[model samples]
Target chain A: MSELLSITATGLTKRFGDVTAVNDLSLNIHCGEIYGFLGLNGAGKTTTIRMLLGMIRPNTGSVSLFGIKVQPSQSSIWQRVGYMVETPHAYPDLTVRENLEITRRLRQMSATDAVEKIIGELGLMPYANRRARTLSLGNAQRLGLAKALIHHPDLLLLDEPANALDPAGIVEIRNLLRGLAENSGVTIFISSHILSEVARLATRIGIVHEGRLLKELNANELAEQEEQRLAVDVNDTVAALSALGKAGIAARLDGKNSLIITDKPTMQHPDKVATLLVEAGCPPTRLVVEQRDLESYFLGLVGMKEEKKQ
Target chain B: MIASVKAPDNIISKLVPALWVELKKVQRSKTLWMTALAFSLLIIISGLFMYILKDPEQARRLGILGAKAQIFGGSANWPSFFNLVLLMVSLGGLIIFGFIFVWIFGREFGDKTVYDILSLPTPRVTVVIAKIITAAYWSLALILLVFVLMLGLGAMLQLPEWSAATVWNGLGLLLGTGSLTVLICIPFGLVASFTRGYLPAVGCIFLVIILGQVISQLGNGQYFPWTIPMLYSGAAEALIGKVTAPLGLISYILVGLVGAISLVFTCGWWRYADQT
Candidate 1:
């Protein structure tokens, strides 16, 4: 209900006969924030995006964009919203430029050069005259982004924007999105299955599993939750464990060849552990600090790994 | 602040851009050209049949005439040729015109581009209206193409019974049948929208055509929307006049009512139904 919120959905629920696609979902995204919606496939990410764009209606709740309630008949609010849902699809027979032109005209923009500008911005010039059916998946994705961005709207709801892009293309889009948020103040709600991609770009991340948001964390909080451990490769693992234990720093054997220590003090000061090991005549051969990646963190939060552990 | 900008009050103002977009999409697709060619081929083939009927002895000598040529009623004239064209439109128009409606609406779902247009700055109703209007214009274009081709081919074949009044009457019936056929095909757009693809709509068209034939043969052609157009085109008179009644005012009203209801249903579906 807050006017300042750029996107708001309250008690949003959608059920298809016996299946509930999205359940009691609520989200509030503010201006200029890159909100990452992270979920596995069939986790209702696309369904939520569809609801937000008014492509599908929620059975039990309301969605508002820019403080105005969303209805299928409403158009003025859409002028300020740009969205790319699921895989971007254009008329296969139409050229990339023609596809963009159709979107520009449908959006009712008077500027004739908007299509040209977006084509250039998205690096679609090389394939501008090519039919969409002929383009590779990467180029097709670029075309989809071009259509969504042609009007330069204030809000963007992208579903897997990096689905088929190369590493460089993904980085370019990341930088472009960063610039859009920083310079133009565009509020972005991007959904992705790639945890690292979202971790690197989002200011806030919401992890959804089984149609429910399991957690919402900011950048600093996510970084803090990353599990850190001190790994040491000693000439004698038993001696190293004994040395660390005698020093009151608990360490366990890992992989039958290395010692893993999650003890706060030992992780904070690996040099002290090295000295203790050396004093015990079990000098370390290799020592390094390792942190859990975003992928593992996401999987751990979703209990995907717990099933594996069990 | 950007959200506060008011949309245009006039429907036409909002409709123009959407219409332009729809036309552009139609122009880019091969469906229009393909349909036009199909109708042209129908006209030319009908002309060839007339040519064979023109002189049975010559046609038989040339091996072009078959025993079925008797269906031409042993005549090759403007009146018969025009009636043949009317029948063609009444029958072929259901598929051709229905295909146009199906592709125009169903391609969005097939190409998976429905999501792109569903949340655009233009109202969904405007988009639907624009598509309907485009389909109307496109169907007219096809009808016009058939009309012109039939005239030129008829002239080239130099069939008998050429008169201004006859030609005018023929043209009137052909056009009236074509218009009614186009009006009835609007419901296919609703089928396409509801079913969200081309196959189901095409199936619906075939079902209606078959059902129309069966119902018309049962002596209730005037009561069915699909049969009414063919009845108005004089198909019943040519085939089974004794059983079919004259098409009444209620029949035309029924056609109009079906069209209006389908259009309203399609618009309502776009406006209120969940589009997953």
Candidate 2:
């Protein structure tokens, strides 16, 4: 592994009995890069995260973090890495502060104010004295994040970080993570099933489907991958469809009675379609260029892969 | 020019913080207080029996107590009281101490918090060691508290035979039997770890208790880890007149080996086994 790489997993493969959980998985996450691992629910996201953290050893390959080999015995590497595998859980009987204190001690953080600072940063100050079992799901998730961040780790591996959070809490965590990456240069590997959530913060996104990386794209490249179309609304949808088809621009009516044009030429030139509709005596009521959102693109990729498998 | 060097990390420094974390979990949970309450109740019941045995004439007026007291061969002296306490400790310690061990190890799985500790600056083996140490001391503290309660109850009842030798011997037997019982409870930590829950481990404890009672009745109590403490405490002799000879060193060796193997296996499981 290169010295600049924070995480490197080469040809990693894990199998649970006959089921291959992760197959031929390889990653090279650089220092201070936010790598979003996008997958569906059972798409081997958590399994891959566990393998990265050395919670589960890969059957065929290996992982290294911060130039040190990732193994159960390598305790020093964890000093610079923080992670939350799945739904975060705490000792139900301990207060929020006490739970954080336990994590602080286990992480060997000597600073006295580390617990209080994290509690305040995660907006958990009100529930600091409250027992963990009594906190709401959002607050419990915050406590989990606080534990991971209390040590000021250089690399964070979060699986479904937005799980069990309200919209505002999600935005707050997003901003916090963005600030960490921008200011402190913390390298984060976040895995989530929601592409929209990951797309908003991830600088590099890896789309995984059925335990295989389908595609990897930079944040800017994601826009290029999205399928574009020109949706046209008119008083007579049938007339607009015929006009576009007669003009050799293959178009179909969508569920909402709008003409959907997937041809590149028509997508690039919506004004030409407007002129065609005007000449056809059904002036266009609406003509707008539309691009697929990140979520649909993700589903299309996964669905396309599934179809190929079948 | 001057040279600066960093100190090497030792196991003690690593264990201290993990041990502190484990002890904090033990202190904050209700299992400790509940087990103490259960042990106290057992002690109070032993005292009630001692009171009944002390006053058989007063018990004769009561129906069942009169009949039971007549058939009882043991008197209500300090020696008999100490014997009763030892027998109770040997039998009750298996259930209580076994529970403490399971709770300390298995609660991490039950509460779904095992993953957090698995990857940390502290190694997994260190975490296991800290838990085992906490469980050991916690079991010892509960045994000590019950022993003190028994002493106070004996004083209040004013049983005869107050020799210093008798007190010392009783204390020795209680501590020895309690220690042996705690030793056998170590394997339950392994059971809890591999099974990933408390139900199987708790069931295993009860199975061991039943088998220990039956096996002790069959005169092979010296070989069984669960029955060794009872045999050593002379409970087999006092309760059923079955065990006559004193336990040899082999019995203690067997208990120690069981504990050592269990500790090793627990640590190895945490280190090598896939936690998923």
Highest-scoring model, TM-score? 2
Could you give candidate 1's per-residue lDDT for residues B142-182 as a string of tens digits?
87888789889889989999999988887787778877877
Pairs of residues at least 3 apart in sequence or in different chains that clash in candidate 1: none
Q: Give Cα distance to truth, residue A127, candidate 2, Å.
A: 1.5
What digit string (tens of lDDT, one per residue) describes model 1 on residues A1-310? 4557899999998888988888999999999899999999989999999899988889999999989999865777888998998889999999999998888878877778888888999999999999999999999999999988888889999999999999999999999999999999999999999988998999999999888888999999989877888888887898888878888988877665787788887798888988888899999988998876678788888887522110
TM-score of 2: 0.92
- For model 1, what is the alpha-carbon lDDT of residue B268? 92
Interface DockQ per candidate: 0.56, 0.49
Who wins the lDDT comparison? 2
Give per-residue CA lDDT, model 2, range A92-116, as digits (tens). 9999999999998888776778889
TM-scores of chain A across candidates: 0.85, 0.86
TM-score of chain A of 2: 0.86
